[model samples]
Target chain A: MVMDTKQPFEKLVELHGATVLRVCRAVVGPGEADDVWQETFLSALRAYPELPADANHEAWLVTIAHRRSLDSVRAAGRRAMPVGEMPDGRSPLGNPGPDGDGVWDQVARLPDKQRRVIAYRYLADLPFADIAGILGGTPAAARRSAADGLKKLRTLMAETPPQGGTP
Target chain B: MTSTDRTSRTGPVDLAFAPHLTAIEPGALHRLRSALAETATREGVLDIAYRIVDSPVGQLLLAATDRGLVRVAYEREDHDAVLQQLAERLSPRILEAPARLGSAAAQLDEYFAGRRRGFDVPLDLSLSAGFRRTVIQHLEGIPFGVTESYTEVARAVGNPKAVRAVGTACATNPLPVVVPCHRVLRSDGSLGGYIGGLEAKSALLALEAAP
Candidate 1:
């Protein structure tokens, strides 16, 4: 494709911005998702001119988003907590808001590999082959991880009944 | 990649995750977009910034570079095609950042309302060059409500035999109303060709002519 024939970067953001944000929130938690989202696109903008016109824009953006989420998670680990006392409850990766349905909180409880598999497959709608590439595993293994994650979620949801439901 | 039985079992997960997928807050997205635009500008990656504004003629597309306002296209020109041409001609790093073109839009608004005579916004005349550029530069000197013949403009630009060339420049003027292309007329005192079409030419002339 001709160099000048490329669509503006704004169109890319408009098309995939929300999906990338969802991926970021699911991967790094909502608290740091915005920061990661901004970083992902800023990096993308820096490289957008060189991206091939035939490239899969959504997958390419998801890949960038995945890397940014990892960076956010690592940075969050290195930051010193200001709280004097630590809570006795499990230190889930994300904050399960007071009013939220707590499905996300259960997702936060999932093992890292399973959490990432679910996020990439379900949230980003990426194929297992793509997920395997992102997570460094075989397509079958990625599929197994997704199944395991869903199975565990179902068990967890069953054990903890939906809050504020009908009597 | 899976069988029907497996899909049925795993299908519930998709539904459960659907709500979280769309958890975007409009306010947060707006803030993120604004912040991203600012950072792009600061980093000098923003090549062309554009926005649309309503006018008596129609909605006008205003585009600017870091130097100054570059292009002002009327609705009849097909804004999308114009933008595509801009992307091909300029860099592809374009954004719909209204703030960068705010001053230009305001000045145009003032001019359209008949409160302002001359445009004070800095212009990027890169789209026009050579004779066309010289013709537009001279057109700016014709004053707010005055008219000039294409023949007279040709002579003014030191090319007495270039009357047709002067008309071509006015017809291809990238910044129409701002460059005052509507002020140029045929030798018979009739309106000549305008890039924004005849109705817009009439509208602009009438706006300038009104008391």
Candidate 2:
């Protein structure tokens, strides 16, 4: 018997788009987040019905965005600087006021592996198992990496001198 | 409030990263919906059927034409809004028929089941042209379980310096999933920006990378 397996796409968007966008922003920075977000959904639309019902769909889309975001960043590097380097003047972890530049700076300073893992597991809020797959490691390894990265971040935070504190 | 006061309250780290953490505004959703609806309602166009396809992450509102699929939206109450937008942007002929999208819908079903890898469907990409089309066309070549960087895609398309433009094209991709835009990544192997949201993007990448 043929099942009437028609799933509504609107519901999926409402439920998942916000979470997906959050993760994308964290992974790639806001400068190029929206582009990746749009591309992710477009890819989903074409492949939705084929997606395994039992499979973790959220993980699937996040993986796609991650790869795409990475591609864009690499592409930006190959292209002529898009009008000054990525505003490196800002402090890596200082408050940039309402603009969020400070947080982004800190995130940028993170080693590539630590940054990707942290962004995926913490900022993007993905599970370690899923993060592992994205990073091509075991779930346990991914979790350990994330933990180590977070620990280092906390250390970095502690070591940072207060703005007005004596050197 | 003064910058100093703001910094003191949220703390320097919080203040610096707060903007990046801020969610997409509800107004943007409203505007996107409105824009899509307007574009779907333009005059003199043929039927622009739309439907919502439920997936693992969220609902995907897909709009199509007799020629092929046109637009796909994520998370909006009024799917018709995008259809209307399409109508306004191009020509009005939007309708609603699941049967018309039989081939696409079928392929999608197979893909979700993990029974399929790529799609084989005629597309209607009147919304994009020139460099955008070139970028998307090359994007299709990215095999499942494999990925390429935006710069790589640009070079493949014969314009290495257009990597940024390639990214812009990806951002503006009118037909996303079918074109496999999610397979692109950074040279450093980090996730990138996505319009449908990064979670979904990551989800797609994860699915591809899964054993």
Candidate 3:
């Protein structure tokens, strides 16, 4: 039945705001996620009116966020900051507790492709097919990237060990 | 695994790791919403701002342009559909920025509580035009607690033959309750059609009739 009603831009924000924030934080770091989020949504709001009624808003939002994150990444690369140091002191995941640093540090250490695959797969809850549509390559390749990312992440976490644990 | 649809599945990542990635800072969403509203306004793209208000009648959808209060919708009117309609007719750059409609919401609260008799907020009136606009403008002059027949309004608008047209105007009034469309009744003193349903119309009339 082709329902052509376009919801208010606010509805889109309410529905996907958190997921997009997580995607932004994962693709970029937590320190820069908010800015990327703002840019992504501003762009979305500007183009929302013209979007086809039945288009998948979630996928569309993630695509915009992915592009914006890439832009910021390129911008940061041009600046040529020292490796292994965050621009800010905040934990990678914005986790404040002592135990959080190890988990997010490993995530931040991941190669860009793995980091994004894990993010889009777990955080955004997008299918591999959709993730491939955003990131390029086939659905199988996207799945493989996510699997490799998870395996690598688990290994890193195992090596790090939790801070307050039984000796 | 290729045969299985992956859309319905979750990632193999352990549940414990999920929280680390999804943890949102306190006030993050609040800050985002405020920032979006501000940016949209500053960019001159917030074409229509809307908010919801609770009243003796029901939840009312109050929408305004920079010009002033543009739409006052009843719950029965389907607020979502109303917003979509507004998006189509007006610009699609609408946001839930309450500040623009703050005055209108406050006025409605006062009116429903019987503390205020008439609304003083600026109105866009662009939604209604020609004969409908003329009829709606005449409806504003309708004093509180006083009811006028559609026939009377038709003659007052200088078109005695447009009685049915007057009813049509009142039926399509974008801003009900505030516009006093409930004040217009059938010539036989029977309740006529209301965009907000007959019960809402009766509730509005009863609210006004109160001492």
Top-lDDT structure, candidate number: 3
Q: 2 or 3, which is superior by lDDT?
A: 3
* Per-residue accuracy of model 1 over A1-167 as CA lDDT, tens digit each: 45446777777877777767777877777877888998899888888879887788878888888888777766665574545433423334565633655666777777777877887887777889999988897999999999988898778877875563412
lDDT string for model 3 (A36-114, tens) is 9998888988888789988899889999999998788766756765455444222233323335455567677677888
DockQ of 2: 0.05
DockQ of each: 0.37, 0.05, 0.36
- Kindly provide the TM-score of model 1 when superposed on the true structure, using C-alpha atoms: 0.86
lDDT of 2 by residue, A1-167 (tens): 43323334443455566666656665666666666776666556556556655566668878887788767766765573545434423222221323423445455555666666776665455678889889897999887776766676566545562342221
lDDT of candidate 3 vs native? 0.82
Judged by DockQ, which candidate is best? 1
The lDDT of model 2 is 0.63
Candidate 2 chain A, run of 10 with poorest lDDT: A88-97
Model 3 clash pairs? none
Candidate 1 lDDT tens digits, B30-99: 6888888888888888888999999999999999988888899999999888887777777678888899
Give the residue spans of candidate 3 off by over 4 A.
A1-3, A74-101, A137-140, A161-167, B1-9, B25-27
Chain A superposition TM-score, candidate 3: 0.84
